[model samples]
Target: MTATIHSLPRKAEPSLEPLMTLVADGLNSVNTVILDRMQSRIPLIPALAGHLIAGGGKRLRPMLTLASAALLEYGGNRHHKLAATVEFIHTATLLHDDVVDGSDMRRGKKAANIIFGNPATVLVGDFLFTRAFELMVEDGSLKVLRILSNASSVISEGEVDQLTAQRQIETSEERYLSIINAKTAALFAAACRIAAVVAERPEADEMALDAYGRNLGIAFQLADDAIDYDSDAAEMGKDRGDDFREGKMTLPVILAYARGDAEERKFWEAAIIGHRTSDADLDHAIALIGRHDAVEATRERARHYAARAVDAIAHFPKSDAKAAMIEAAQFAVARRY
Candidate 1:
């Protein structure tokens, strides 16, 4: 599909810049802890982990952990190690995800599979995953482990479900939500919940932080799906139309197919479901998405989630960390560049 697109996410209630300042500094400290914790008997493990670790991502999960801990007034820097643990877990997932999806790029660079081979990349991902569990054990809390383990399970399940569900055309929003919650929001929920655990906060605060992460993650993934059609390869750091090529079921294509006129619907059936797609069919799909405003509609929904994520943090008393956490939620929605 070929069409122009535009989105101007509504302004955040509070500017995220000041909060990002604190988060930016904390990440360095977190990385240090992650590195120190990783010094172990298996030297190959670290070398393999290093290959993917060096690839830059947004670091959203670790940011949530540190910010949430700071909000609850954690005195020491324990959150730093935990934050790195969170990042390591997240990176491990990405490595496995790329392998599973046969992906070519991440953060606008060659995927580990391209550089290190799929087997090595897969093993490194395994190393990071185990290391994440090992690092979190230092917290000496089963609650934290439970959250992370559950997230890991859910993420795995989600990946499997998505593999089966993609390009099926019969996929529903209800099913999509289930898949994304498991695949995307599970980790996000864990990240925020772990911070609350670190603070020894009340259950209500923990639940709210969990909700914040869940909502933020959903919004982030939805926005990502919305952008896939026209995203610049350079900007997205990956191939455009990847979800389409892979026959993935994402919000834009689903809503567009549901709402499209007869001819447009046929395009989805022939190109997407039947895999009979030609350039003409592709362009038609793109046009129908724009005509029905599917992408914009998804963006609107994503913004609503971001708003809810910000509101969830209101339970904590205002602090630099809290503000940063809130801004991170806002950043999840509007951070296109």
Candidate 2:
């Protein structure tokens, strides 16, 4: 069925001034460390690696890593390395994702696939993946490696599953959520849990952190999907309606299709499943979907995850870091182009 939020005008930017300040500082350290290490690699690797490393993003994963650690009162500066490693792993995945999806743009610039071609993007992504492994080894923590390795495996497998399920009208929520866990939630869970694993926190604490990351990731992805309904190319940095244009069956379309009238359903079936959608057709589809509550339902789901994320960090013992991590969940739900 349709949901509600997108029918309204944009809300005020979520109050993240305090969290932004902390998240920004953490991001700065993460960017420096990640860029420096990426450049240290062999030339071809560095050029490709640096290309994405220098690209602008919210840098949420590294922020999650460092914030979780600080909440646990980690004393060593080694969290910086893990934070950079997190970014490397994230950037590498994006490289592969663009190539696999044949995307032309990301973050307001040509995707590596568009600029360097698919082959270079794939190979460079592989290089960065290897580099992340090498750096993880330096940490000398089997626990860290275990977390990251598992996440990487899941991410790869999840991507394959999503590709396999493409244009799949029969996809269920259980199946969709499973894919989300693999493609999106895995790394988020790992990022938060890695900090706890490193800090020697209680088992309960680690589990809670894992929950925080998983829910945060889910919220972020859901919000991302919501934006696709009317995403502004200049602001969101990608073509608006890219997901719909690709026939990806994101939450909005899925919800709308399920609840649509026969004519509405036929419109989607022909334009989407039948592979005949044009830009004008896609815009019409977005407006039709909005006539229902599809986008609002998706936002509500995102807010649910955001709330769960906040609850997950509740037991972390209050600190600026802890508060900011909680606030990040809200930020994920509320961000706009």
Candidate 3:
């Protein structure tokens, strides 16, 4: 069934800009670490990494690490290093994802793979992955290392899972959740959980923050999937309907397929499953999704996850940082791009 924003429950959201501003100093430190580590004698390594890293991406994952640390009143430099590590992991994933997805644009600019050869992009991604581990080892905490390392493994597994599920019309919601959890949410969970670890906070607090990040990550991905069909390339960093073109079985596609009539199901099977879609077919797909309110339904689902993310932080003492974290959860679902 179709749903509207007014017809479904939603959580209050504040803009992410304020959250970034609140942690501006910490984010600056993270950026410095990112710049320093991207350097290499090979020249191309730093150039390729910097192209995307300096690209106007939001840096949300590292900000989570910084904000979580601040929320706990942790006053140490380790979180800065760890935040940079989280960003490296995220940036590495983006590099690999562009190659895997064969995307031509990133952050409204030509993709690194489009400029530098795919081999270089892939190798630079490897370089950043190794750099992340170096930072982790430098932190000298087995617990932190274990958490990020496992998250990295899960992220790779998630990518493999997504590869397996491509153009799969019958991909179930449960399977989709597993893929997103591993590819996207796992790092977020690790980033926030390690914040509590660095602060020497109790286990309960760490788990709570982990839950928050995981749910927020899920919400963020859901919104991104929905936006792919609705937003302009300039706003979304890629062409509209890229998911449909790629035959990706995102939540909106899955929902529209499941809710379609027999003839409509055939259309989806042809376009998404059979890979016979064209630009006109994408337009029809968008119309079908709108008729079924699939995009709105996905956004509503994102709201549910965002609410859970906000609720997970209830135990933390009220502070500006804590409030900003809560708002960040809301922002995940509410953001247009």
Candidate 4:
């Protein structure tokens, strides 16, 4: 008798829809605050800021704030304004980042700096930061104010550190993690910690949420770095190989360079130092990354952090909010764009 063979079903890819659905109403309120606060007497201020604010970002940072509040079952409207503040801080950073990177595209559209000019973009970024502070002050929570303000400062310091590391192939994994922890993860931690403050949750709870956000942020950044070199990856809004061309010294480059042979090392040295910048050069770089499995290695690193993010909230009683948070961390590692 011949036996019939059965194939196992593939696991479905993780998605952000559950988290988005959980925070939908709260996010709507946050959007209202964002639109109202972003308005200004100076037409250019609103116009330039609106260009990026209306851009197709997932608004992940603020959504984390809202979701954290929901997880705590917090019944207050204060988080809406605070969530908007989180978004302002994030948007300000993006505006400045595009200008610093000399990017041509943001959220699949022309970057604010390209359309409004670098000076205007920078000023608008400053305007958003001021608005963020105003919102924090209006909330009348010194603790909240401190957390967010410190995050803003850390983000700036991280940006400066990354600028110093740019084109420096000597940038170590430890140093790169330090930079991302401050620049990218700091705001995520702040966003989640403030939810505990609003909910009157204990310090331990606050720390737990902070850990979750921080790890998730690192995972998100790592996945993004891997995508920049992954040939089969979908377009991620920004120009492909922007990190390579800019010599950002991301994890993939670090791994590939470390694992490369002598001839490959020579090619990487030339690429990182601005000697190789053509499309052909980028193709070769991608090929080298593939040969070393650097992209997969970076993604594996992301999965590690994503698992930590999930465990950070594991003690919480099972609820829709908790499940959504767990899935969000999985999505961070699994996302291609």
Model 3 TM-score, all chains together = 0.96
Each candidate's number of clashing pairs is 4, 8, 0, 0
lDDT for every model?
A: 0.78, 0.80, 0.89, 0.90
Q: After superposition, how far is residue 139 of candidate 4 from its true place, in Å?
A: 0.3
lDDT of 2 by residue, 185-264 (tens): 99999989988888988889888999989988988888888888856888798888788767787788888888889988
Error of 2 at 301 (Å): 0.4
* Highest lDDT scorer: 4
Quote the lDDT for 29 in model 4.
93
Task: Kindly indicate the candidate among 2 and 4 with the higher TM-score.
Answer: 4
**TM-score of each model, paired residue for residue:** 0.90, 0.92, 0.96, 0.96
For model 3, name the residue pairs that clash: none
Q: How accurate is candidate 2 locally (lDDT)?
A: 0.80
Residue 100, candidate 4: Cα error in Å is 0.9
lDDT of 1 at 159: 88
**lDDT tens digits, residue span 1-337, model 3:** 3233343233454588768988899999889999999999999999999999999999999999989998999989899999999999999999999999888999999999999979999999999999999999999999999999999999999999998999888899899989999999999999999999999999999999999999889989999988987787878988787788888899999999888899989999999775667878988999999999999999888888887787788778889898888778767877888
**What RMSD does model 2 have?**
3.7
The per-prediction CA RMSD against the true structure, in angstroms, equals 4.8, 3.7, 3.0, 5.3
Candidate 1 per-residue lDDT over residues 131-171, each given as its tens digit = 78887788778888888888888999998999899778879
Span of 10 residues, lowest total lDDT, candidate 2: 1-10
